[model samples]
Target: MASALPNSLFQQYFNNNDYADIIVELKHPVQDTNCPKSTEYFPMHQIIACSTSTYFKEACFNAETNPIGTKLLFFDISLEAFTIIAAWVYGFRGSSFERLFTEKSIRGVMDFFIDHDLETDIYPEMQELRTLLLKNLFKITTEAEVASATGSPRMDLRSLEDICEYCLPGDRNTIRRLVKQQIPQIKCSAGWLEALAGKSAAGFLASILLEIYQEAQIQ
Candidate 1:
């Protein structure tokens, strides 16, 4: 269980942005042809970020650690994702996926969370982000859209498995669409079929397969 801080304190921290004690700097690696590296800075309260995120807590203010400077540099993550994470740390709602987040970008953030051993108890917002990402991925329509959303040719098998495991029970229609998109791969992959058969909600999987069979018969 997590302890709750007073709402007034969160509001106070948010209202006074100038009182930020830490700076999170995001940088892109140098590209070709003499184009300068891109960098963006986010000023944040150490207490808020550290309290909500294991990564920030360890990087910025682990009590027994040697001094890491005030400004922390991250090369792999995008400025937009970091900005939304920083806001969530301060008790503000994270931004919508349509505006800033993508499957690839959120995966980077998820890796950061995992590498730092971020606890869901400490950061409920991480759970929120995960759910949102799953929903958005299931909603995607095309191969090009998948490439654009995730920077991958297709949704990877692990991600598809996760969607089946977590999201299938809630919204079958969306899950059906997602599965339909991958039918070509699923038809050829014994591992995928076996994995779906092993799910707790095997009935749902059976229903989807039946629907596919019926559609094929009609065609």
Candidate 2:
């Protein structure tokens, strides 16, 4: 999912009550203004809206994109986008990126995940994360070759927007929501992010999500 509003921009407005009001208004803008048919800024607005939806995914985007509704769901959840959003929301709890990028705290979060192993635990935000990851993947992968190459653990995320621009338009929304959902769960844990930076994280998350769904089914 493309975020029309960047975290940096949102950060500037965070302290201003009026700006917060503007953001709140932006979230629930007038019906006509909500997802306009076509406009120069519609794409940008759509992306920003999708990004912010992480915080209010239930109120707005739930009906549009369901993670369990799609195949290859977790593959599409963009960890980078989620990372950016998470940092914005929880960065205050840590030191600077350089200062906080320590082995101990990172390991702490990873250990939390290893010991906790979500298994059947389904989070309210999983769908949102799937949406975001797909958006990032689409944005980064250009050709079939690039797409295939992305399966490698060493793939770069910065190329996401490029892949996104090339993918079919219809697939974008689904990708956005998946990623948005996962940001909150993963963000607070520095170790989670660090561990997920490698190749196996996507498959790990996918397996975890499937387990969650399976447990839900039995329940």
Best by lDDT: 1
lDDT tens digits, residue span 167-215, model 1: 4354567667767765433432434555576667454754665566566
lDDT of 1: 0.56
Model 2 bad stretches (over 4 Å): 13-85, 88-96, 112-219
lDDT of each: 0.56, 0.33
List TM-scores for all candidates, in order.
0.51, 0.22
Error of 2 at 162 (Å): 35
Candidate 1's displacement at residue 172, Å, is: 15
lDDT of 2 by residue, 1-219 (tens): 234544566444432433121122111122376574321110112233335544334323433433433211111112322233333342222233223332233332233223333112243233333333344343333333344764422223333322332223344445334434422121223344344335342434433334434544576
- Pick out the ten consecutive residues of candidate 2 with the lowest summed lDDT: 70-79
